[model samples]
Target chain A: MDLRDLWAESLAGMLARPVRSALTTLGTVLGITTLVVTLGIAATAGNQIVGRFDELLATSVTVDVPPSSRGPLVSWDAPGELRRLRGVVSATALAQNEESSNLVVTANNLLDPTRVFGQTLAVVAAGPNLPETTHGRLLAGRFYDAGHVARHDRVVVLGEQAAAMLGITRLDHAPAVFINDRAYTVIGIIGDLRRERVLASAVLVPPTLGPDFGLKDVTRVLVATQLGAAELIARQAPLALSPSNVGELQVIAPAGPRRARDGAQDDVNGMFLILGLVSLVVGAVGIANVTLVTVMERVAEIGLRRALGAGRRHIAGQFLLESSLIGLTGGVIGASLGMAAVVGVAAVRQWTPVLDIRLALAAPVAGALVGLLAGLYPALRAARMEPVDALR
Target chain B: MPEPVIELTGVCREFPSDPPVRALSDVDLRVEPGDYLAIVGPSGSGKSTLLNILGLLDRPSSGSYRLDGVETTELRDGARTRLRGARIGFVFQSFHLLPHRTVVENVMLAEVYGPHPRRGRRARAEQALEQVGMGHRTGFAPGRLSGGERQRVAIARALMARPALLLCDEPTGNLDSRNTEAILDLFDGLRAQGLTILVITHEDGVSARAGRRVRIGDGLLTEQG
Candidate 1:
């Protein structure tokens, strides 16, 4: 018989008992559904969580430069040399004056001792690129530039929180804050520090004016590199800053976002792959059991067909087609349900759903293959039955 | 020079019991077109075995079988099936229609296993049902039909292939005497139209309807009419 007719007959046989067919197909549906859901959520969650990680932590590197007792571990011109390196967005040296560690910082020169506006805030000496390295924005005037540092103009920038605490808003008046008894003019307010959020409440100044307030050596070198460039910059930062004592400086660079994303996807898929496979095994078993029962139940019919003219191959082919069609139907239904579940989850969580189209496309084919393999033993058994024996 | 529809020479069947029981031995039988023959015997006689060998359902332990001028003893499994399907149709006493299929679908099942299967098989099946006087019950499942009606549908299924030989094994065993007479009338009508038919039965009344009668006893064949 032609393949079209053979397939139609097999389909009619399956349709004869609708409830049994539906029950047999359920196992495959659950298997395919689990597979799709696991993969969908893995891709979506990985895309979302890693995207933010790439933006905030993955692109920033911090190097702690220890004081050398007699001389600075890094020179003031180190940032200039490092900026010429590839992928270096900004590099700034941060240091604190030794004597100002215990001094109270204030924004207003109020004579009354009972009131405190800007106190216990850290005062830091920085190079020109402090705002860029921290991924912060100026809410008021521009940050004190190289010109100010070169001129030793004693200019300072207040962090957003520091300015709020001290009641210093607009830099149109050029407000000045005091550390102990010394005054430094505030030229700008830095806000939105993505990395190193503690800097949003500090008082920032150019390093040229730091020695007078007892500042000695650079303590921290904050570096912001381009996306996916943190690893290389982390390896090279200490060497570039201190040619002889690279080991003394500690470079703290978070892992790359691409790596984190891949790792996350792999982890999620690894865990769920087992569940998918277990479900598929259960499905295969169901197909095998049901197909065997069908063969047993239809012994007389099979024998009569054999007597009429059906060959072994024809008998085997009919049963195999019967199972594969069941699997394909289950796979189609399961895939749609899984995709809907993933989209629903993403919608609830406010994430952009990421789906791999190839996975969806392959599921039905996989299910069909599973059905074919599952039907192999039963079909062979049916085909091998002798017409005389079956009829008896 | 017309070829006989069935030709059997020295056919034997041995059931491998502890003491190998010989069901048939050196049996030779021939039936040409328009022949209506019946083989009858009591239980443990070789009538069923002779019928099985003739129907191509069982291979003889030794000897040759030719159905419609083709040597079947040496034919491969698939070729034998095609030869049998094209040349032979069977009707069992129990009316072996698939319990789930409608009468029309049951008849079309023969066409499904035919050499060139296609979509227009329904028309041929309907025509076969009409020939068997079962056209009115085409849409009914076998369970819904009475014994007589189900036997008619089975006959329709048998005739759908246009086989040269209609092999009936106890076709009237489960029928009432009236239904048996009716089925025998249908068989007579079919034989009158030039088809070779073989009936295997244990009842003398059933064997009396055939044009020629043969009795099998203890694996031996003897012509009775």
Candidate 2:
């Protein structure tokens, strides 16, 4: 038979049992839909995760300055120099006195003469840009600036937890916290530290009081860079801090987010792709089963065709074409449904949907291939019947 | 003087059962162009076997059967199928009309597998339907047609390829006397138009309408006077 006639025959055969054909196509639709939905959702979710990662952990770089025998390894003004480098959003130097954690702090020593409110709190001295470097917010008052550090003023910023513990809520009356019996005015209360979370429960003071607090040298410099510039900034921060002794400062920068994002996406794709293929396999089996049943049901028709002089290949071709057409139809429907599902879910969840154009185009062809394979056995079986036996 | 449409010599067909049943035993037959011949026999008389072998639907255990100058016994399956499609038309007792198709579409199916050009197949089908007086029912589905009408449609389908021979097996088995008489008259009309015809049936009335009749019993054939 000609191609046109073959196609017409297949179509007529399918239309003969409309409900069965539709049910058979449904199997392929589900398989392709799962494939498109999973891949699209994985891509969108992975991008969102990487975006959040880039905003926080991927941008922060810390340079740890270990204690050196040659006195202070990093100068207090080294943060200002590192901040001059490209891609650096903010940089701050921190010094913690070894005995500051052991100091007794009191909210009101004069009111409580028995020292009933004394508590041991860590005191960390930082540069003027501590709030910017740590991505922290000031809950009340203001942070100490360059003037406070240069003039050696005894002003401290209380961390959220520390301020609560010392019963200092309002700075209206110029609240003071005594550290080791030395009174220091509270300038600000800093909270919500995205980086250096340990600072949330400590007292932050200017670096000029490091010697008085027994902080011998600058301990670390916290640097925040622009997204995708963390690794470059990490390498350059040590050289910028102490050009002569860059080896003394250890820089800790997070691994690139691209690799992590790809790994996550691959894992997601692998898992869902298998499920899609399994569903496709099931759909293929459904087509095969239906085609076989159709072959069995049309035995007499087959015999009549043979008597009319249809070659075995022609009979097989007609059945194979019918199944493939069904698969193609299902694939198109499934691809559309899958994309719609992805977009719908993304819309509901407020995510930007991601779908590959190639995948969309390939889905139907893949479905057709599945149908072709599924119809092979049944078509062969139909073709193998002798005209005499079939007619009988 | 024209070549015989069918020539069968020493044709034998066997079924390999536990006892090896011989369906057609050394049956020899010949049919000329424009001939209307009938092979009549009761059940298990090898009538169907002879028809199957004549239509190239079955192979003889040992024989030489030639159709239209082609040694069909020596032909490959594809060649045999092509030859059959190009030369022979079949009409079964049950009509075998596709119920889902219109009468015209059923007629058109006859040329679908043949070597004929498909460009004007519908026109030809309509013309053949007209020849069998089923032209008016071209758009009607087979389910809506009477037994006589359905047989006429089958005849129209068989005539689509302009085949050299029309083969019928119990053509009026399911028809009432009136429809049977009508079908027998149609066969006579087809024969009058120079078409060779072969009918396999046990009915005396059906065989009496043919120009020649043969009797077969227990895998053996005998020409009737």
Compared with the true structure, what per-residue lDDT tens digits does model 1 show for residues B1-225? 799888889988999999999999888888888899999999889877777788788889999898989999998888888888888999998888898888998998887777745656898899999998988988998999888888989998899899999999999999999888889999999998888889999988889999989899999888886
Residue A159 lDDT in candidate 1:
81
Residue B34, model 2, lDDT: 94
lDDT of 2 by residue, A1-392 (tens): 78888889889988888899999999899999989888888887788778778878898999999989988889999889987899999999998856876677788776666546676788998988988988899999999999998899999999999898888999999999998788999989999887888787888888888777788589988998998999999989998889889887899998899887797788789988899999999999999999999999999999999999899999999999989988988999999999999889889988778888998999999888889999999999999999998888
Give the worst 10-residue stretch by lDDT in candidate 2 chain A: A110-119
Candidate 2: residue A145 Cα off by (Å): 7.8
TM-score of each: 0.93, 0.82
Name model 2 segments beyond 4 Å from true.
A67-69, A77-91, A95-216, A226-229, A232-250, A262-277, B115-118
Candidate 2 CAPRI level: medium
lDDT of 2 at A269: 90
Chain B TM-score of every predicted model: 0.97, 0.98
Q: In model 2, how well does chain A match by TM-score?
A: 0.84
Q: After superposition, how far is residue A336 of candidate 2 from its true place, in Å?
A: 3.4
Model 1, stretches more than 4 Å misplaced? A97-102, A111-118, A169-174, A265-271, B117-119
Task: For candidate 2, list the clashing residue pairs, or say none.
Answer: none
